[model samples]
Target: MFNRTENLSLYIKKYPVISVLIGMNLIVYLLGLIPGIGNNLYALGIAYNYSISQGEYWRLITAMFLHGGFLHLLFNMFGLYVFGPELEQLAGKLRFFSIYFISGLLANVATYVVEPLNYASLGASGAIFGIFGAYLALVYHTRKILPQLKQLIIPLVAISVIMTFVQSNINITAHLVGLAVGFILGMFQFTPKRIRRFREK
Candidate 1:
Protein backbone atom coordinates (compact mmCIF):
# COMPACT_ATOMS: atom_id res chain seq x y z
CA MET A 1 0.00 0.00 0.00
CA PHE A 2 2.94 2.35 0.70
CA ASN A 3 4.40 3.20 -2.63
CA ARG A 4 6.12 6.23 -4.18
CA THR A 5 4.70 5.87 -7.64
CA GLU A 6 3.13 9.29 -7.89
CA ASN A 7 4.89 12.28 -9.37
CA LEU A 8 5.49 15.36 -7.17
CA SER A 9 2.33 17.20 -8.23
CA LEU A 10 0.06 14.20 -7.87
CA TYR A 11 1.57 13.22 -4.54
CA ILE A 12 0.94 16.68 -3.14
CA LYS A 13 -2.59 16.63 -4.50
CA LYS A 14 -3.18 13.28 -2.86
CA TYR A 15 -1.53 14.17 0.45
CA PRO A 16 -1.59 17.91 0.78
CA VAL A 17 -0.91 18.03 4.50
CA ILE A 18 2.21 15.98 4.12
CA SER A 19 3.24 18.13 1.19
CA VAL A 20 2.70 21.38 3.07
CA LEU A 21 4.61 20.11 6.08
CA ILE A 22 7.53 18.87 4.02
CA GLY A 23 7.44 22.16 2.15
CA MET A 24 7.43 24.07 5.42
CA ASN A 25 10.39 22.11 6.67
CA LEU A 26 12.26 22.80 3.44
CA ILE A 27 11.41 26.48 3.53
CA VAL A 28 12.56 26.77 7.14
CA TYR A 29 15.74 24.88 6.43
CA LEU A 30 16.46 27.15 3.50
CA LEU A 31 15.81 30.19 5.68
CA GLY A 32 18.33 28.82 8.12
CA LEU A 33 20.88 28.85 5.33
CA ILE A 34 20.90 32.63 5.02
CA PRO A 35 24.09 33.90 6.70
CA GLY A 36 22.79 36.36 9.29
CA ILE A 37 19.11 35.38 9.07
CA GLY A 38 19.75 31.67 9.47
CA ASN A 39 21.49 32.07 12.79
CA ASN A 40 18.65 34.18 14.16
CA LEU A 41 15.98 31.69 13.12
CA TYR A 42 18.06 28.83 14.49
CA ALA A 43 18.44 30.57 17.84
CA LEU A 44 14.75 31.31 18.04
CA GLY A 45 13.59 27.98 16.66
CA ILE A 46 15.86 25.44 18.33
CA ALA A 47 14.28 23.71 21.35
CA TYR A 48 16.39 24.99 24.20
CA ASN A 49 14.89 23.98 27.54
CA TYR A 50 15.88 27.20 29.24
CA SER A 51 14.27 29.32 26.55
CA ILE A 52 11.13 27.21 26.64
CA SER A 53 10.84 27.53 30.40
CA GLN A 54 11.35 31.25 30.08
CA GLY A 55 8.15 31.31 27.98
CA GLU A 56 9.32 30.91 24.40
CA TYR A 57 6.65 28.32 23.92
CA TRP A 58 6.65 28.70 20.16
CA ARG A 59 9.87 26.74 20.03
CA LEU A 60 7.97 23.55 20.53
CA ILE A 61 6.30 23.96 17.15
CA THR A 62 9.19 25.60 15.39
CA ALA A 63 11.68 23.00 16.52
CA MET A 64 9.70 20.39 14.68
CA PHE A 65 10.42 22.25 11.45
CA LEU A 66 13.96 23.38 12.17
CA HIS A 67 16.92 21.19 11.31
CA GLY A 68 20.57 21.40 12.28
CA GLY A 69 21.71 20.51 8.78
CA PHE A 70 20.76 19.28 5.35
CA LEU A 71 21.29 15.64 6.17
CA HIS A 72 18.96 15.94 9.14
CA LEU A 73 16.30 17.56 7.00
CA LEU A 74 16.81 15.06 4.22
CA PHE A 75 16.48 12.02 6.45
CA ASN A 76 13.37 13.37 8.20
CA MET A 77 11.59 14.60 5.07
CA PHE A 78 12.41 11.33 3.38
CA GLY A 79 10.89 9.42 6.26
CA LEU A 80 7.77 11.55 6.06
CA TYR A 81 7.65 11.16 2.32
CA VAL A 82 7.89 7.42 2.62
CA PHE A 83 5.47 6.79 5.50
CA GLY A 84 3.05 9.73 5.62
CA PRO A 85 0.71 9.15 2.67
CA GLU A 86 -0.89 5.92 3.89
CA LEU A 87 -1.73 7.43 7.28
CA GLU A 88 -3.14 10.50 5.62
CA GLN A 89 -5.30 8.26 3.49
CA LEU A 90 -6.30 6.16 6.49
CA ALA A 91 -7.00 8.95 9.01
CA GLY A 92 -7.96 11.63 6.50
CA LYS A 93 -5.98 14.87 6.16
CA LEU A 94 -7.10 16.82 9.21
CA ARG A 95 -6.65 13.97 11.71
CA PHE A 96 -3.41 12.90 10.07
CA PHE A 97 -2.04 16.40 10.47
CA SER A 98 -3.19 16.41 14.06
CA ILE A 99 -1.29 13.25 14.89
CA TYR A 100 1.88 14.48 13.19
CA PHE A 101 1.80 18.03 14.57
CA ILE A 102 0.74 17.07 18.09
CA SER A 103 3.38 14.39 18.33
CA GLY A 104 6.12 16.86 17.46
CA LEU A 105 4.80 19.53 19.81
CA LEU A 106 4.54 17.20 22.81
CA ALA A 107 7.90 15.70 22.07
CA ASN A 108 9.42 19.14 22.42
CA VAL A 109 7.40 19.77 25.55
CA ALA A 110 8.65 16.54 27.08
CA THR A 111 12.19 17.49 26.20
CA TYR A 112 11.77 20.81 27.95
CA VAL A 113 10.40 19.16 31.07
CA VAL A 114 12.87 16.28 31.17
CA GLU A 115 16.09 17.52 29.66
CA PRO A 116 18.78 19.58 31.34
CA LEU A 117 18.13 23.33 31.38
CA ASN A 118 20.98 23.77 28.94
CA TYR A 119 19.68 21.16 26.54
CA ALA A 120 18.97 22.20 22.98
CA SER A 121 17.71 20.24 19.96
CA LEU A 122 16.23 20.56 16.49
CA GLY A 123 14.73 18.00 14.07
CA ALA A 124 11.53 16.26 12.99
CA SER A 125 12.36 12.88 14.49
CA GLY A 126 9.77 13.15 17.24
CA ALA A 127 7.00 13.96 14.78
CA ILE A 128 8.22 11.15 12.57
CA PHE A 129 8.07 8.77 15.50
CA GLY A 130 4.54 9.97 16.12
CA ILE A 131 3.57 8.88 12.61
CA PHE A 132 5.13 5.53 13.25
CA GLY A 133 3.27 5.15 16.54
CA ALA A 134 -0.11 6.01 15.02
CA TYR A 135 0.48 3.72 12.06
CA LEU A 136 1.52 1.01 14.48
CA ALA A 137 -1.82 1.25 16.25
CA LEU A 138 -3.72 0.90 12.98
CA VAL A 139 -1.57 -1.88 11.63
CA TYR A 140 -1.98 -3.80 14.88
CA HIS A 141 -5.80 -3.78 14.87
CA THR A 142 -5.89 -4.64 11.18
CA ARG A 143 -3.08 -7.17 11.45
CA LYS A 144 -5.43 -10.04 10.77
CA ILE A 145 -6.11 -8.45 7.42
CA LEU A 146 -2.54 -7.31 6.82
CA PRO A 147 -0.24 -9.57 8.78
CA GLN A 148 3.04 -8.29 7.34
CA LEU A 149 2.75 -4.84 8.95
CA LYS A 150 3.09 -6.20 12.47
CA GLN A 151 6.25 -7.94 11.49
CA LEU A 152 7.53 -4.75 9.84
CA ILE A 153 6.60 -2.13 12.46
CA ILE A 154 7.74 -4.02 15.57
CA PRO A 155 11.29 -4.46 14.36
CA LEU A 156 11.33 -0.90 13.05
CA VAL A 157 10.26 0.60 16.38
CA ALA A 158 12.73 -1.53 18.32
CA ILE A 159 15.58 -0.57 16.05
CA SER A 160 14.65 3.11 16.16
CA VAL A 161 14.55 3.04 19.96
CA ILE A 162 17.84 1.22 20.11
CA MET A 163 19.49 3.76 17.86
CA THR A 164 18.01 6.59 19.89
CA PHE A 165 20.18 5.44 22.81
CA VAL A 166 23.24 4.23 20.96
CA GLN A 167 23.52 7.35 18.86
CA SER A 168 24.95 10.42 20.55
CA ASN A 169 23.13 13.81 20.55
CA ILE A 170 19.70 12.21 20.21
CA ASN A 171 16.78 13.44 22.32
CA ILE A 172 15.48 10.32 24.02
CA THR A 173 12.78 12.18 25.93
CA ALA A 174 11.06 13.59 22.86
CA HIS A 175 11.24 10.34 20.96
CA LEU A 176 9.73 8.25 23.76
CA VAL A 177 7.00 10.74 24.60
CA GLY A 178 6.11 11.24 20.95
CA LEU A 179 5.80 7.52 20.47
CA ALA A 180 3.62 7.14 23.54
CA VAL A 181 1.43 10.08 22.64
CA GLY A 182 1.00 8.89 19.09
CA PHE A 183 0.03 5.42 20.26
CA ILE A 184 -2.58 6.84 22.62
CA LEU A 185 -3.95 9.18 19.99
CA GLY A 186 -3.89 6.40 17.46
CA MET A 187 -6.06 4.27 19.74
CA PHE A 188 -8.74 6.88 19.31
CA GLN A 189 -8.11 7.92 15.73
CA PHE A 190 -7.60 4.63 13.93
CA THR A 191 -9.95 2.22 15.65
CA PRO A 192 -13.59 2.45 14.59
CA LYS A 193 -14.79 0.41 17.59
CA ARG A 194 -12.87 2.62 20.02
CA ILE A 195 -14.07 5.79 18.32
CA ARG A 196 -17.66 4.56 18.54
CA ARG A 197 -17.15 3.85 22.25
CA PHE A 198 -16.12 7.46 22.81
CA ARG A 199 -18.95 8.87 20.72
CA GLU A 200 -21.57 6.86 22.59
CA LYS A 201 -20.52 8.42 25.87
Candidate 2:
Protein backbone atom coordinates (compact mmCIF):
# COMPACT_ATOMS: atom_id res chain seq x y z
CA MET A 1 0.00 0.00 0.00
CA PHE A 2 2.92 2.31 0.64
CA ASN A 3 4.52 1.54 -2.71
CA ARG A 4 4.24 3.90 -5.67
CA THR A 5 4.13 2.33 -9.10
CA GLU A 6 2.28 5.17 -10.81
CA ASN A 7 3.80 7.49 -13.37
CA LEU A 8 4.09 11.22 -12.67
CA SER A 9 0.76 12.15 -14.21
CA LEU A 10 -1.06 9.26 -12.60
CA TYR A 11 0.59 9.88 -9.26
CA ILE A 12 -0.54 13.51 -9.23
CA LYS A 13 -4.01 12.51 -10.28
CA LYS A 14 -4.14 9.91 -7.56
CA TYR A 15 -2.61 12.01 -4.79
CA PRO A 16 -3.19 15.66 -5.59
CA VAL A 17 -2.66 16.94 -2.04
CA ILE A 18 0.62 15.16 -1.47
CA SER A 19 1.79 16.23 -4.93
CA VAL A 20 1.02 19.86 -4.19
CA LEU A 21 2.83 19.66 -0.85
CA ILE A 22 5.90 18.09 -2.41
CA GLY A 23 5.79 20.64 -5.19
CA MET A 24 5.52 23.54 -2.76
CA ASN A 25 8.48 22.29 -0.71
CA LEU A 26 10.47 21.70 -3.89
CA ILE A 27 9.66 25.16 -5.18
CA VAL A 28 10.62 26.77 -1.89
CA TYR A 29 13.90 24.88 -1.77
CA LEU A 30 14.72 25.76 -5.37
CA LEU A 31 13.97 29.42 -4.73
CA GLY A 32 16.21 29.34 -1.67
CA LEU A 33 19.02 28.27 -3.94
CA ILE A 34 19.09 31.76 -5.40
CA PRO A 35 21.99 34.02 -4.32
CA GLY A 36 20.69 37.14 -2.61
CA ILE A 37 16.98 36.38 -2.49
CA GLY A 38 17.68 32.98 -0.97
CA ASN A 39 19.08 34.36 2.25
CA ASN A 40 16.26 36.88 2.58
CA LEU A 41 13.52 34.36 1.93
CA TYR A 42 15.03 31.88 4.37
CA ALA A 43 15.25 34.51 7.05
CA LEU A 44 11.56 35.11 6.59
CA GLY A 45 10.61 31.45 6.18
CA ILE A 46 12.02 29.98 9.38
CA ALA A 47 9.85 29.55 12.48
CA TYR A 48 11.61 32.16 14.51
CA ASN A 49 10.28 32.65 18.02
CA TYR A 50 11.08 36.35 17.91
CA SER A 51 9.19 36.73 14.66
CA ILE A 52 6.21 34.85 16.07
CA SER A 53 6.27 37.02 19.17
CA GLN A 54 6.45 40.08 16.91
CA GLY A 55 3.17 38.90 15.33
CA GLU A 56 4.61 37.06 12.34
CA TYR A 57 2.74 33.93 13.37
CA TRP A 58 2.51 32.66 9.82
CA ARG A 59 6.01 31.31 10.20
CA LEU A 60 4.59 28.27 11.98
CA ILE A 61 2.75 27.33 8.82
CA THR A 62 5.25 28.64 6.26
CA ALA A 63 8.17 26.90 7.91
CA MET A 64 6.48 23.58 7.23
CA PHE A 65 7.12 24.18 3.53
CA LEU A 66 10.68 25.46 3.89
CA HIS A 67 13.92 23.49 4.07
CA GLY A 68 17.54 24.23 4.91
CA GLY A 69 19.07 22.23 2.07
CA PHE A 70 18.40 19.88 -0.84
CA LEU A 71 18.67 16.74 1.24
CA HIS A 72 16.45 18.30 3.87
CA LEU A 73 13.75 18.84 1.27
CA LEU A 74 14.35 15.46 -0.30
CA PHE A 75 14.04 13.47 2.92
CA ASN A 76 10.93 15.27 4.12
CA MET A 77 9.26 15.07 0.72
CA PHE A 78 10.17 11.41 0.46
CA GLY A 79 8.47 10.78 3.81
CA LEU A 80 5.40 12.57 2.49
CA TYR A 81 5.63 10.76 -0.82
CA VAL A 82 5.64 7.35 0.81
CA PHE A 83 3.33 7.68 3.81
CA GLY A 84 0.97 10.53 2.95
CA PRO A 85 -1.19 8.84 0.34
CA GLU A 86 -2.22 5.89 2.48
CA LEU A 87 -3.31 8.24 5.25
CA GLU A 88 -5.05 10.44 2.70
CA GLN A 89 -6.90 7.42 1.42
CA LEU A 90 -7.78 6.14 4.87
CA ALA A 91 -8.51 9.45 6.57
CA GLY A 92 -9.74 11.30 3.47
CA LYS A 93 -8.18 14.51 2.15
CA LEU A 94 -9.59 16.96 4.65
CA ARG A 95 -8.63 14.90 7.67
CA PHE A 96 -5.22 14.20 6.20
CA PHE A 97 -4.60 17.90 5.70
CA SER A 98 -5.70 18.64 9.23
CA ILE A 99 -3.47 15.97 10.72
CA TYR A 100 -0.44 17.23 8.81
CA PHE A 101 -0.77 20.99 9.13
CA ILE A 102 -2.11 21.01 12.66
CA SER A 103 0.64 18.76 13.86
CA GLY A 104 3.21 21.05 12.24
CA LEU A 105 1.67 24.18 13.74
CA LEU A 106 1.50 22.62 17.18
CA ALA A 107 5.10 21.54 16.87
CA ASN A 108 6.17 25.06 15.97
CA VAL A 109 4.03 26.50 18.69
CA ALA A 110 5.65 24.16 21.17
CA THR A 111 8.98 25.39 19.97
CA TYR A 112 7.90 28.99 20.37
CA VAL A 113 6.72 28.32 23.89
CA VAL A 114 9.87 26.57 25.08
CA GLU A 115 12.81 27.85 23.10
CA PRO A 116 14.61 31.16 23.20
CA LEU A 117 13.05 33.98 21.17
CA ASN A 118 16.00 33.78 18.80
CA TYR A 119 15.20 30.14 18.08
CA ALA A 120 14.38 29.34 14.46
CA SER A 121 13.75 26.08 12.60
CA LEU A 122 12.79 25.15 9.07
CA GLY A 123 11.68 21.79 7.65
CA ALA A 124 8.67 19.47 7.27
CA SER A 125 10.11 16.94 9.69
CA GLY A 126 7.58 17.95 12.30
CA ALA A 127 4.73 17.31 9.90
CA ILE A 128 6.34 14.15 8.62
CA PHE A 129 6.73 12.92 12.16
CA GLY A 130 3.02 13.59 12.58
CA ILE A 131 2.39 11.22 9.71
CA PHE A 132 4.53 8.67 11.47
CA GLY A 133 2.54 9.15 14.65
CA ALA A 134 -0.71 8.73 12.77
CA TYR A 135 0.58 5.51 11.33
CA LEU A 136 1.25 4.26 14.82
CA ALA A 137 -2.31 5.10 15.76
CA LEU A 138 -3.51 3.24 12.71
CA VAL A 139 -1.49 0.18 13.52
CA TYR A 140 -2.95 0.12 16.98
CA HIS A 141 -6.44 0.69 15.62
CA THR A 142 -6.23 -2.13 13.12
CA ARG A 143 -3.89 -4.46 14.88
CA LYS A 144 -6.21 -7.42 14.47
CA ILE A 145 -5.95 -7.55 10.70
CA LEU A 146 -2.93 -5.37 9.99
CA PRO A 147 -0.57 -6.62 12.62
CA GLN A 148 2.23 -6.58 10.10
CA LEU A 149 2.39 -2.79 10.16
CA LYS A 150 4.14 -2.76 13.53
CA GLN A 151 7.25 -4.31 12.03
CA LEU A 152 7.76 -1.54 9.52
CA ILE A 153 6.33 1.44 11.40
CA ILE A 154 7.70 0.88 14.90
CA PRO A 155 11.28 0.54 13.72
CA LEU A 156 10.93 3.55 11.43
CA VAL A 157 9.56 5.70 14.25
CA ALA A 158 12.20 4.47 16.67
CA ILE A 159 15.01 5.25 14.26
CA SER A 160 13.59 8.70 13.57
CA VAL A 161 13.39 9.59 17.28
CA ILE A 162 16.88 8.28 17.79
CA MET A 163 18.19 10.30 14.89
CA THR A 164 16.54 13.41 16.28
CA PHE A 165 18.86 13.28 19.26
CA VAL A 166 21.93 11.91 17.48
CA GLN A 167 21.83 14.53 14.74
CA SER A 168 22.97 18.09 15.27
CA ASN A 169 20.64 21.09 14.85
CA ILE A 170 17.57 18.88 15.05
CA ASN A 171 14.48 20.32 16.72
CA ILE A 172 13.77 17.64 19.29
CA THR A 173 10.82 19.43 20.85
CA ALA A 174 8.94 20.00 17.61
CA HIS A 175 9.41 16.45 16.47
CA LEU A 176 8.24 14.97 19.78
CA VAL A 177 5.36 17.37 20.20
CA GLY A 178 4.24 16.84 16.62
CA LEU A 179 4.37 13.10 17.09
CA ALA A 180 2.34 13.31 20.29
CA VAL A 181 -0.26 15.64 18.81
CA GLY A 182 -0.52 13.56 15.67
CA PHE A 183 -1.16 10.43 17.69
CA ILE A 184 -3.82 12.17 19.75
CA LEU A 185 -5.50 13.59 16.68
CA GLY A 186 -5.18 10.31 14.92
CA MET A 187 -6.98 8.63 17.77
CA PHE A 188 -9.58 11.36 17.76
CA GLN A 189 -9.96 11.32 14.00
CA PHE A 190 -9.92 7.55 13.64
CA THR A 191 -12.08 6.46 16.50
CA PRO A 192 -12.78 2.83 17.35
CA LYS A 193 -16.34 3.15 16.16
CA ARG A 194 -15.13 4.76 12.98
CA ILE A 195 -12.55 2.09 12.39
CA ARG A 196 -15.05 -0.66 13.02
CA ARG A 197 -17.50 1.06 10.71
CA PHE A 198 -14.80 1.35 8.07
CA ARG A 199 -14.03 -2.33 8.34
CA GLU A 200 -17.69 -3.17 8.09
CA LYS A 201 -17.97 -1.09 4.96
Candidate 3:
Protein backbone atom coordinates (compact mmCIF):
# COMPACT_ATOMS: atom_id res chain seq x y z
CA MET A 1 0.00 0.00 0.00
CA PHE A 2 1.18 3.51 -0.80
CA ASN A 3 1.29 6.23 1.79
CA ARG A 4 0.24 9.57 0.41
CA THR A 5 2.25 11.53 2.95
CA GLU A 6 5.37 9.56 2.25
CA ASN A 7 4.95 10.00 -1.47
CA LEU A 8 4.51 13.73 -1.07
CA SER A 9 7.59 13.95 1.12
CA LEU A 10 9.65 12.16 -1.49
CA TYR A 11 8.32 14.41 -4.20
CA ILE A 12 9.15 17.52 -2.19
CA LYS A 13 12.68 16.33 -1.63
CA LYS A 14 13.14 15.52 -5.30
CA TYR A 15 11.85 18.90 -6.44
CA PRO A 16 12.58 21.51 -3.84
CA VAL A 17 11.76 24.59 -5.93
CA ILE A 18 8.47 23.23 -7.21
CA SER A 19 7.59 22.09 -3.74
CA VAL A 20 8.31 25.52 -2.33
CA LEU A 21 6.22 27.19 -5.02
CA ILE A 22 3.28 24.89 -4.43
CA GLY A 23 3.60 25.47 -0.71
CA MET A 24 3.57 29.22 -1.21
CA ASN A 25 0.47 29.11 -3.36
CA LEU A 26 -1.28 26.84 -0.91
CA ILE A 27 -0.33 29.02 2.03
CA VAL A 28 -1.66 32.13 0.33
CA TYR A 29 -4.86 30.36 -0.59
CA LEU A 30 -5.40 29.15 2.94
CA LEU A 31 -4.75 32.57 4.36
CA GLY A 32 -7.27 34.06 1.96
CA LEU A 33 -9.95 31.70 3.23
CA ILE A 34 -10.41 33.71 6.39
CA PRO A 35 -13.63 35.76 6.36
CA GLY A 36 -12.47 39.36 6.02
CA ILE A 37 -9.06 38.49 4.67
CA GLY A 38 -10.28 36.87 1.46
CA ASN A 39 -11.82 40.06 0.13
CA ASN A 40 -8.85 42.15 1.23
CA LEU A 41 -6.47 39.68 -0.33
CA TYR A 42 -8.43 39.84 -3.54
CA ALA A 43 -8.27 43.60 -3.49
CA LEU A 44 -4.52 43.41 -3.34
CA GLY A 45 -4.07 40.25 -5.37
CA ILE A 46 -6.31 40.82 -8.38
CA ALA A 47 -4.88 42.67 -11.38
CA TYR A 48 -7.22 45.33 -12.68
CA ASN A 49 -6.25 47.80 -15.36
CA TYR A 50 -7.46 50.78 -13.38
CA SER A 51 -5.87 49.64 -10.17
CA ILE A 52 -2.58 49.09 -11.96
CA SER A 53 -2.73 52.50 -13.57
CA GLN A 54 -3.22 53.90 -10.10
CA GLY A 55 0.10 52.35 -9.00
CA GLU A 56 -0.99 48.90 -7.86
CA TYR A 57 1.90 47.37 -9.71
CA TRP A 58 2.39 44.58 -7.17
CA ARG A 59 -0.86 43.00 -8.38
CA LEU A 60 0.94 41.66 -11.40
CA ILE A 61 2.97 39.34 -9.20
CA THR A 62 0.47 38.81 -6.40
CA ALA A 63 -2.37 37.81 -8.70
CA MET A 64 -0.61 34.64 -9.68
CA PHE A 65 -0.90 33.25 -6.14
CA LEU A 66 -4.53 34.13 -5.50
CA HIS A 67 -7.44 31.84 -6.36
CA GLY A 68 -11.18 32.45 -6.41
CA GLY A 69 -12.07 29.04 -5.02
CA PHE A 70 -10.74 25.70 -3.96
CA LEU A 71 -11.38 24.30 -7.40
CA HIS A 72 -9.33 27.04 -8.98
CA LEU A 73 -6.47 26.33 -6.64
CA LEU A 74 -6.70 22.62 -7.27
CA PHE A 75 -6.68 22.95 -11.04
CA ASN A 76 -3.73 25.30 -11.14
CA MET A 77 -1.74 23.31 -8.61
CA PHE A 78 -2.42 20.18 -10.61
CA GLY A 79 -0.83 21.89 -13.58
CA LEU A 80 2.16 22.96 -11.51
CA TYR A 81 2.52 19.47 -10.15
CA VAL A 82 2.45 17.96 -13.61
CA PHE A 83 4.79 20.37 -15.33
CA GLY A 84 6.78 22.38 -12.82
CA PRO A 85 9.30 20.03 -11.31
CA GLU A 86 10.53 18.69 -14.63
CA LEU A 87 11.02 22.17 -16.02
CA GLU A 88 12.75 23.31 -12.85
CA GLN A 89 15.10 20.35 -13.08
CA LEU A 90 16.01 21.27 -16.63
CA ALA A 91 16.24 25.05 -16.19
CA GLY A 92 17.82 25.02 -12.72
CA LYS A 93 16.26 26.88 -9.79
CA LEU A 94 17.04 30.47 -10.77
CA ARG A 95 16.02 30.16 -14.39
CA PHE A 96 12.92 28.21 -13.48
CA PHE A 97 11.93 30.92 -11.03
CA SER A 98 12.60 33.52 -13.71
CA ILE A 99 10.38 31.73 -16.22
CA TYR A 100 7.53 31.31 -13.77
CA PHE A 101 7.43 34.82 -12.26
CA ILE A 102 8.39 36.82 -15.36
CA SER A 103 5.92 35.02 -17.59
CA GLY A 104 3.17 35.18 -14.97
CA LEU A 105 3.64 38.91 -14.32
CA LEU A 106 3.83 39.66 -18.02
CA ALA A 107 0.68 37.67 -18.66
CA ASN A 108 -1.22 39.71 -16.11
CA VAL A 109 0.23 42.92 -17.55
CA ALA A 110 -0.88 41.94 -21.03
CA THR A 111 -4.39 41.26 -19.82
CA TYR A 112 -4.43 44.56 -17.96
CA VAL A 113 -3.58 46.40 -21.15
CA VAL A 114 -6.22 44.76 -23.32
CA GLU A 115 -9.01 44.02 -20.86
CA PRO A 116 -11.77 46.35 -19.74
CA LEU A 117 -11.01 48.95 -17.09
CA ASN A 118 -13.15 47.09 -14.56
CA TYR A 119 -11.78 43.70 -15.47
CA ALA A 120 -9.86 41.95 -12.72
CA SER A 121 -8.00 38.64 -12.90
CA LEU A 122 -6.23 36.29 -10.48
CA GLY A 123 -4.80 32.75 -10.54
CA ALA A 124 -1.75 30.68 -11.50
CA SER A 125 -2.93 29.67 -14.96
CA GLY A 126 -0.56 32.09 -16.63
CA ALA A 127 2.48 30.63 -14.90
CA ILE A 128 1.34 27.10 -15.64
CA PHE A 129 0.80 27.98 -19.27
CA GLY A 130 4.29 29.42 -19.29
CA ILE A 131 5.59 26.07 -18.10
CA PHE A 132 3.65 24.37 -20.88
CA GLY A 133 5.02 26.75 -23.48
CA ALA A 134 8.54 26.18 -22.19
CA TYR A 135 8.04 22.47 -22.67
CA LEU A 136 7.06 23.06 -26.28
CA ALA A 137 10.20 25.11 -26.83
CA LEU A 138 12.31 22.44 -25.16
CA VAL A 139 10.84 19.84 -27.48
CA TYR A 140 11.47 22.02 -30.49
CA HIS A 141 15.06 22.66 -29.58
CA THR A 142 15.77 19.04 -28.86
CA ARG A 143 13.63 17.54 -31.60
CA LYS A 144 16.45 15.50 -33.00
CA ILE A 145 17.27 14.07 -29.60
CA LEU A 146 13.62 13.58 -28.64
CA PRO A 147 11.77 13.70 -31.93
CA GLN A 148 8.60 12.19 -30.54
CA LEU A 149 8.11 15.00 -27.98
CA LYS A 150 6.99 17.40 -30.74
CA GLN A 151 3.95 15.30 -31.61
CA LEU A 152 2.94 14.70 -28.02
CA ILE A 153 3.44 18.12 -26.44
CA ILE A 154 2.14 20.38 -29.26
CA PRO A 155 -1.31 18.78 -29.48
CA LEU A 156 -1.62 18.76 -25.72
CA VAL A 157 -1.01 22.50 -25.49
CA ALA A 158 -3.27 23.22 -28.48
CA ILE A 159 -6.13 21.24 -27.02
CA SER A 160 -5.82 22.96 -23.67
CA VAL A 161 -5.88 26.38 -25.35
CA ILE A 162 -8.96 25.37 -27.30
CA MET A 163 -10.70 24.20 -24.15
CA THR A 164 -10.23 27.62 -22.57
CA PHE A 165 -12.98 29.04 -24.81
CA VAL A 166 -15.75 26.98 -23.22
CA GLN A 167 -14.83 28.10 -19.74
CA SER A 168 -16.07 31.19 -17.92
CA ASN A 169 -14.18 33.58 -15.60
CA ILE A 170 -10.92 32.52 -17.19
CA ASN A 171 -8.41 34.84 -18.81
CA ILE A 172 -7.46 33.48 -22.19
CA THR A 173 -5.38 36.53 -22.97
CA ALA A 174 -3.21 35.93 -19.95
CA HIS A 175 -2.79 32.30 -20.87
CA LEU A 176 -1.73 33.04 -24.45
CA VAL A 177 0.68 35.78 -23.49
CA GLY A 178 2.27 33.59 -20.83
CA LEU A 179 2.63 30.76 -23.30
CA ALA A 180 4.22 33.00 -25.91
CA VAL A 181 6.71 34.40 -23.43
CA GLY A 182 7.59 30.98 -22.10
CA PHE A 183 8.09 29.60 -25.59
CA ILE A 184 10.37 32.46 -26.52
CA LEU A 185 12.38 32.06 -23.33
CA GLY A 186 12.58 28.32 -23.80
CA MET A 187 14.16 28.71 -27.22
CA PHE A 188 17.15 30.22 -25.51
CA GLN A 189 17.04 28.01 -22.43
CA PHE A 190 17.07 24.67 -24.20
CA THR A 191 18.77 25.11 -27.54
CA PRO A 192 19.92 21.69 -28.82
CA LYS A 193 23.43 22.68 -29.65
CA ARG A 194 23.83 24.49 -26.39
CA ILE A 195 22.50 21.62 -24.33
CA ARG A 196 24.57 19.13 -26.27
CA ARG A 197 27.73 21.11 -25.70
CA PHE A 198 26.93 21.45 -22.01
CA ARG A 199 26.41 17.71 -21.81
CA GLU A 200 29.75 17.13 -23.54
CA LYS A 201 31.53 19.40 -21.07
Q: Best candidate per lDDT, number? A: 2
lDDT by candidate, in order shown: 0.87, 0.88, 0.85
Residue 127, candidate 1: C-alpha displacement in angstroms = 0.6
Which lDDT tens digits does candidate 1 get at residues 128-159? Answer: 99988997787667677667878778887888
Task: Mark the regions of model 1 whose C-alpha exceeds 4 Å error after superposition.
Answer: 193-201
Taking all chains together, each candidate's TM-score versus the true structure is 0.93, 0.93, 0.91
Per-residue CA lDDT of model 2 for 2-101, tens digit only, reads 7788899988987888898898888888888899988898888899999899999989988998888888888899989988887887787789988999
Candidate 3 lDDT by residue in tens digits, 1-201: 012333787898877888888999999999898899888988877887789989989988898999889999999998888767767767888888888888898999999999988988999888888888898898888777878877878887988798788788789999999999999888888777766765575
Per TM-score, the best of the predicted structures is 2
lDDT of 3 at 197: 65
Model 2 spans > 4 angstroms off: 192-201
Ranking by TM-score: 2, 1, 3
Candidate with better TM-score, 2 vs 3: 2
Q: Give the better candidate number (2 or 3) by lDDT.
A: 2
lDDT of 2: 0.88
RMSD of 3: 3.3
- Greater-TM-score candidate between 1 and 3: 1
Which 10-residue span in candidate 1 carries the lowest summed lDDT?
Answer: 192-201
